[model samples]
Target: MTDVEAQQAHWAATFAAHPEMYGGQPSAPGAYAVELFVREGCRTVLELGAGQGRDTLAFLRAGLRVTALDYAAEALAGIEQSAGADAERLATVAADVRRPLPLPDASVDAVYSHMLLNMALTTPELEALAAEIRRVLRPGGLHVYTVRHTGDAHCGAGTALGDGMFENGGFVVHFFDRALVDRLATGCTLLDLTPFEEGDLPRRLWRVTLRREGP
Candidate 1:
């Protein structure tokens, strides 16, 4: 199988084995994204890589309509189960973000993702995904994502997967630097990029927020 296929399989198995791998609590970045969504009066949100529906639950609890997408079917299943009564407000889709998103143009008020952009995607793939994100977001819509920066402890510690990517524990990650972050924002106006830490190891991350212009 190709590298992408291998990565996909690995993620599927990983999520199947550990449905709540990241637990139910939303990440700090995700909470902050939700705050921005509320402040911007965003009612519809598209959540990419919605593992275990952690952030999806948070968004639903905030009374926002969320379209959650994840490559792993098991993850989506977990999301659906966790949504329960709030399932009416959540739509789950199984999709790989490296390809064109299965969403309509200007369909969502905001896009939120946590640590999804820093996956095993190449630079070109990242650019394409960014363009698709811009296409799906309405005018003045926000795109908030987080990535492990080059300064992270695991930046170059794992087996090399080419294109600044590394594979560890059957998972591949592409560490991002400032230049890569800038390249990924080709189609949007980057509003803010700040550093933050999370988890027991205190993983260093770059929380990036962008806006699709033209109202």
Candidate 2:
């Protein structure tokens, strides 16, 4: 299998082995996105890489309609199963992020992701992904995403895979730099950028908030 295919298979196996891999609680970025979206009067949220639906549940509990997207079918099922009372408000989509997002233009009020942008995607792919996100948002919609930046402890710790990506323990991470972040925000309004950390290793990250500019 190619590296991309291997990565997918590895994640599938990993999730299967440990259903609660990232635990059931939402990440710090997830909570932040919830507050931002709610305070901004957002009605719909598109959560990319909604792993195990921890953050998705948080959004639902906050009374926000969330469409959770993950390439793994098992992850989608986990979201659906764990949604419980919030299932009615949760829609899960299983598809690869390498391709165009399967949603209509100007459909969502917000696009929120936690570490989704720091995946194994190349720089060009990330640029395209940002464009796709901007297209799916309403004129004044928001896109809150977090990524592990070059400043992270593991940023350069693993096997170099080119384009700021490094593979460690069968998984690949595309660490971001300010230049790439700024480039991705070309058509959008860069609202906020906050640095934070997560996990036992305390992975450092940058929480970025971008708004689609319009009336």
Candidate 3:
């Protein structure tokens, strides 16, 4: 199989193995980010790579309408099972975010992504995804995201080579430092980026909140 197809298969297995990870019941940082967004008044949200609706459920429970987007059918099934009738509050779609975001311009009030950008794209693909995000988000819409921040220690199935690249589950993961992210968000107005500890791990994380330029 091609790289994209192999990557998709990997995530499908990962999500299937751990459905609860994406079912709105995260233990720490993930939960914190989701709670903060809704508390800050993100009413209509779209989550890219929303595996099994974890953050999506959090938003819905907080009275925010959500659209959960993931490419894995198994992941969506798990989300549906966990959400039950409340699932109606969510619109689940299967699409690759690296391509054109399957929505009209300025369609969503906010975009929330977690751990999605780290694995799914090359530098060029990331640029395209950022552009798509800019296109789909309403003027002044918020973009809340967390990506793998640069630090020490090996985690996941990946071993760090001499450089910043890692091989986790046989897929290459590019860890981003703060400067890298700032460059990527050049077009968007950055609101805030706070670094925080994740769980009992020594690794660092960036909680970024950006806004699409207002009309």
Candidate 4:
């Protein structure tokens, strides 16, 4: 398999192995941060690399329209299952963020991702994803995301897969430093950035919120 295909397979297996690794509860710091920063509206929201529909379901529950995109078929399937066949508010697409996402330009009111940017990708690939994100967001749109901080203990502890790739139980993670993320998101205005702890977990993480540059 190619590099992207290999990465996709790894995540597919990871999701299948531990479907509940992220916990069934709707409580990730990134999700909470996005909801807090972005307003609730009738317009649509796009969530890239959505895994198991955690953020998508949460937003749908809050009465927001959401389109959840991921490259792995298993991930999208799991999201549908989690939605229990009644979640008409959520739409699913199996697509990669590094390439052209399925949506058209300026089609979304907001874009949100969680632990999506740092996974098994080089700086160039991340930059491409950032550009695609910029293309799809409408003017004044908000972007919220969290990246695995490079110094997090679970990274490179010999138990890790290799290089910047590591397995967090059922989820494979890619670690990043702040400088790298800023470089990837070169053209956007990083409105606010703050470090947050998840469920009192002992790890350093960042919540980054940005606005699309005005036309």
1-215 per-residue lDDT for model 3 (tens digits): 75556778887877667755533575354566567666666677888887767676777777777788888877777777777667778888899877798889998888988778777466777778888998888988888888777763443346764334577656666677777788778668998887766555555677788988966
Write model 4 residue lDDT over 1-215, tens digit each, in one string: 76666778877787888988877666465456446644544367888888877778777766677888898877887788788644787789888776778789988888888877867776677778888888888877878888878777777654476546776654556777778768766667888888866645566678788888866
lDDT of 4 at 207: 76
CA lDDT for candidate 3: 0.74
Cα TM-score per model: 0.95, 0.96, 0.86, 0.84
Residue pairs in candidate 2 whose N, alpha carbon or C atoms collide under 3 angstroms:
none
Which residue pairs in candidate 1 have backbone atoms (N, alpha carbon, C) closer than 3 angstroms, thus clashing?
none
Note the residue pairs that clash in candidate 4.
Answer: none
Candidate 1, residue 44: CA error in Å?
0.7
Candidate with better lDDT, 2 vs 3: 2
Q: Write down the TM-score for model 2.
A: 0.96
Runs in model 1 lying further than 4 Å from the true structure: none
lDDT of each: 0.88, 0.90, 0.74, 0.75
Looking at model 4, residue 206 earns an lDDT score of: 81
- Candidate 2 lDDT trough over 10 residues, lowest sum: 1-10
Error of 4 at 123 (Å): 0.2
109-183 per-residue lDDT for model 2 (tens digits): 999998888878888889899989998999989999999999999989979999999998778999999999999
